[model samples]
Target: MISGPSENPELWAFLESLHRGEILCGTVTAIERFGVFVALDDGPDHPVFRGVGVITIPELSWQRIETAFDVVQVGQHVSAEFLQFDTWNLEARLSLRATQPDPFQAFADRTAAGQELHGRVTKLVPFGVFVQVTDGIEGLVHLRELTSTSVEKPSAVVQAGDEVTVVGTEIDRERRRLILSRRQGPTAH
Candidate 1:
């Protein structure tokens, strides 16, 4: 069934407290062949919604196919587990990797201009060249910042594993972004 913004009084109030990361119990109001639809009971006993979460396919009992009606039945209040709650979306996104370490958390540190990191050029975009510092971390060196020459394509000179040193230009702790540059290398003119 199309989950086009469900409508229910108890579900709305249940989602409010959930946006604040409050655990509110949600009663399975309606279950379709796709998945179970839960309505958080306004009562204090069923407090489950408190963070942003959802009940993805694997998290559910059976394989959650996009178009399957054989997974769940209607009006089956099956004490479903809670993962997270978001007020904007009026829903929660469940995940099995919730307890796992945040992948973006490692990007919190982007300061120290002199802190050199050996990276490889991944792409040669018109704007600049994309460098991969680590497996998941990447920094960009603007085209104008690579060299004062008429560098048209970044790949013209730089390629994969060129052993480029990343010099931090700007640090965004919140955005988890680091503006990097290769123009001011240690041995540059």
Candidate 2:
């Protein structure tokens, strides 16, 4: 179990003062492949790190990025949402994406099952191909839905960067999932 500020009064007091989901403004102090460090405005100084806050790769942005440098740079000002207090690291976990609109939610709002969508195949796995339906939104085209006939692998049907037309078979908003099909005809209602 994670302990609160009472465990270490001085180092954790700044994080204790913050609440989850609270918006915070900070400057990007360091950008690593794994995450970014932020020195929060009006926050206490840290003895070990340049900042008292950290934002992991997944929390940096909603879009799939190759590196932390792609989304942020050192000394850049950023507004992030407080996620949690990291007792081990003695820093507050933050999320830069939380401050931005969720692309998946926006896509789900305007899209419906059976809708036709044009996208580029982003990745191929043993089970399916991931298609980028829109910026920051990728949907899975399961192997079974790749075609009417049986296939051994997704690579046989499509390659990365291949532009394809797919029909949305299911839109699971709660799961943030979109199931797509490329079965050569209108999707059955």
Error of 1 at 6 (Å): 11
lDDT of each: 0.54, 0.87
Candidate 1 structure quality by residue, lDDT tens digits, 1-189: 212235445555654444432344444454444344555354322234332234444545322246323444434433344566544555754432233343445554443655666788877788888787776667788877777576887777677667787776765666656677776757442
- Most accurate candidate by TM-score: 2
TM-score of each: 0.54, 0.90
Off by over 4 Å in 2: 1-8, 184-189
Q: Give the per-residue lDDT digits (tens) of candidate 2, residues 151-180.
A: 999888889999999998889988888899
Cα lDDT of model 1 overall? 0.54
RMSD of each: 9.4, 2.8
Q: Which stretches of candidate 1 lie over 4 Å from their true place?
A: 1-7, 22-90, 93-111
Model 1: worst 10 consecutive residues (lDDT sum): 44-53
